[model samples]
Target: MEPVFEFPLSLDKHGPQTLARRLHQQLRAAIVEQRLAAGTPLPSTRRVAQAYGVARNTVIAAYDLLMAEGFIVTRPGAAAEVADLAQWRQMAPRTRTRTRTRTRPAPPPAIDWRKAQSSEKPIGSAATAASARGFHLGLPDHRWFAADVWRRLLLHSSSFALPDAFGYPSAAGRPLLRAAIARWVAYTRAVVCTEQDVVVTSGAQQAFDLLARVLVAPGHTKVAIEDPGYPPLRAALLAAGAQLLPAPVDEYGLIVDTLPADVRIVCVTPSHQFPTGVAMSLARRQALLDFARRTGAVIIEDDYDGEFRYGSDPLDALQTLDREARVIYVGTFSKIMFPSLRVGYVVAPPWLIGALAAAKQCADNGGNVALQEALARFILDGHLAKHTRAMRKRYASRRDALLGVVERELGEWLIAVPPSAGIHLYARYRDRRQAKRIATLAAHHAAGAQPAGDFLLDRQTTFDSGIAFGFGYIDEAEIEGSIGRFASALRGSYASAD
Candidate 1:
């Protein structure tokens, strides 16, 4: 029978070794190593030749050489088989002495990498569901996202083949995309900037990383981050060797009065304070800008979820008020669009744009060309604004539904933190210790519960315990059931505690 086995053999015509000789040597070595054992059938000459992209004569000659050397046996009208291993071993006498080789241990690392590593879990570590259900943070409802429209835009970008489109994209991003972003932000977020001031990033996370690389002086640069802030931004600052100063946040957002005097950089989610859904007060924004101007500190304003406001006019972005260009506005389409899109941008001042562009170039070479082009078309054609408006209405309805459930069902166990904007709302637990316990219970009920301590810089035990409930991801129709499940989970946790 013709044995079916992958011939893990190759031919290199460019080499000094001929294909037939190389094949012979390989087969001989396989037999010696007992890889091709006794009675193991080899593929026919035609099959081996076809598999290796060589002439049939090459395979025939190699097989003949192996047969002549007594490595293989072939009978009339029978396939070639490996000769008995015992016969080959007897013919080739063992003359060499055996020796044992000792392995040396690898040397210890020179640098203390432990200090450079982060002890805290990454952002959205708990949001591991295939689809966002109850209370999953940072996830928008993917089911509502316009997949068809996005597909069309992507195709539109691919349809026209410009010379530059075929090449590697610019590190700063495509000119069209940068322009579109500049116009879009200027109109929507009150972020006044030209295309020259924008540098497209993989996401808001990469924007922070690139900024850290350019602005931080490693081991000397002092950066101030909100106490219960976004983990990724804090981690980025820490990784850049900045001495992180965790500033406290109140109802109005980051308390500028509490900021340390020597901080050279400040990162804040001023639009809607992450996990807390509190917009930074106008007074606080002015104070922050004044403080930045006073100390020459660069403020990184992460306007992640500024577009989903239910009430009140859109607050002026920190970048809009920065007459001195101290505030570097970072925005992402992940929350506004979908997470996997991996498109975000930085509205940087002219002075910092060049350095940031260079840093981006060194990071991933450049952004995805087609993606950038598609996003550019998506923005310029008014699809982005249209989608965002539709999402805002839907998200607002979800917000109302969540608020209703919290007031009616969860009022006894938790108190709402008064959410004004953003996808999630924070609720302080009646019993602080219950915050950690409820998360596991919530999971059993097919839900999610993110503890406030997960976002804290120091993770102090004394920190007030609360849970962030994301309503943007789950449907309005499912809101009642999801909230019921959440209430059940809370009750279960309390029962266990009793």
Candidate 2:
């Protein structure tokens, strides 16, 4: 047996305090200060009693007190062990330090991040919680996912047989994962590419950041983006020092004629526009590609939620139609699987892939190889495809539930722009007065949502005031009740538009 670890203790045999109480206090202070590390195995009660020249009963009582206070844990047939002291640390008060005075460090040098991004209030604050009744934009139905399958795949992919898994992963990504993604996107999004053209990213957001690094030249670069667009994309490009040119979006999608001729990059979400739920017309898709070809600008096509179309044929990706290699296709597993997975990819032209890969190396070295490996297996084994099909049906039902309530009960107050695909549906009110009323009601019920005006680059610019309902996270059964709450909140807040 291993010898019992010794801890210094000066117990007074003639003191007024009992031996057990003195022992308990010393042991607790040792544990709290980490003199005895967490998870360390404690000696047997009899052994501790003999080592300290005390009765076995004295040690037993002290151990019991420690266990009760969560300082240690004991098992029926095993040695008692120290419990993790993280919670205890939080509970303990800070030690007073009257002997020394602390001085604050000097402030950092001022930085001038010249007008590249917005100074408006953040869309959602850090403290905001994801409520069950809240309409989370672009979130998927997490309940429908197979956690057991993912757990097993993740465990199985953790073996270190491959050299990439053993050491730092390649900046370009694991070869197997890159190849799997190439095949997957080719099959699903009709994107044309090989493993050599694929660059694995943390997510589509990082892919955009990497592109901005390699493509944009700070103040000299002009980048065109869809107005009332994906806010994160616009913000990221602006932070990279690109002069942003916000173009307008119509019912058909981004108007190609309004694109600035001098811009070097154009970012769009054509499959399903964010905040509006509008898909670009086929003519518009072609016109976008032609515009990129003519202007010699790189097209960044972010297909974030293209996997879950409700009732239409999947359109050919902009990359598929680009014969001039002008489009950079960005895809992610966030919406389909889950956001925290942080797995997204970029299919760039042959000449640009190397530079982008190098830029990624300088950014984060590389992403988690084990997660990417498991995801690759998830794709090749057809689990991804199977899960996506199931989620599509469930989300479609949810979409119908929300629309049904709007059309049946709230027709006078709102008008839903029928969405053929994607998780969210956009609804415009007769005016901002009605929209604000509905918003106030939704907030009262803890069912939060975003106003369409939140995405506008220029609030003064003309646009419809509406709310976007992301039905993916909210259950179909709860949709009616949530709408009812909205109706109740709106009661007496405004008169019916009769």
TM-score of every prediction relative to native: 0.78, 0.75
What tens-digit string does per-residue lDDT give for candidate 1 at 374-463? 899889988889888999898888888888887787887777876777888887778875665665655565355576777887766365
Please, what are the lDDT tens digits per residue for candidate 2 over residues 106-170?
98533234444555334433233244535767677677698999999899878776565678988
List candidate 2 stretches off by more than 4 Å: 1-133, 496-498
Q: Runs in model 1 with CA error above 4 Å?
A: 1-132, 492-498
What overall lDDT, based on C-alpha atoms, would model 1 receive against the true structure?
A: 0.82
Q: For candidate 1, what is the total of clashing residue pairs?
A: 0
lDDT score of residue 221 within candidate 1: 94
- For candidate 2, give the lDDT of residue 458: 69
Q: Write down the lDDT of every candidate, Cα atoms only.
A: 0.82, 0.81
Residue 235 shift from truth in candidate 2, angstroms:
1.9
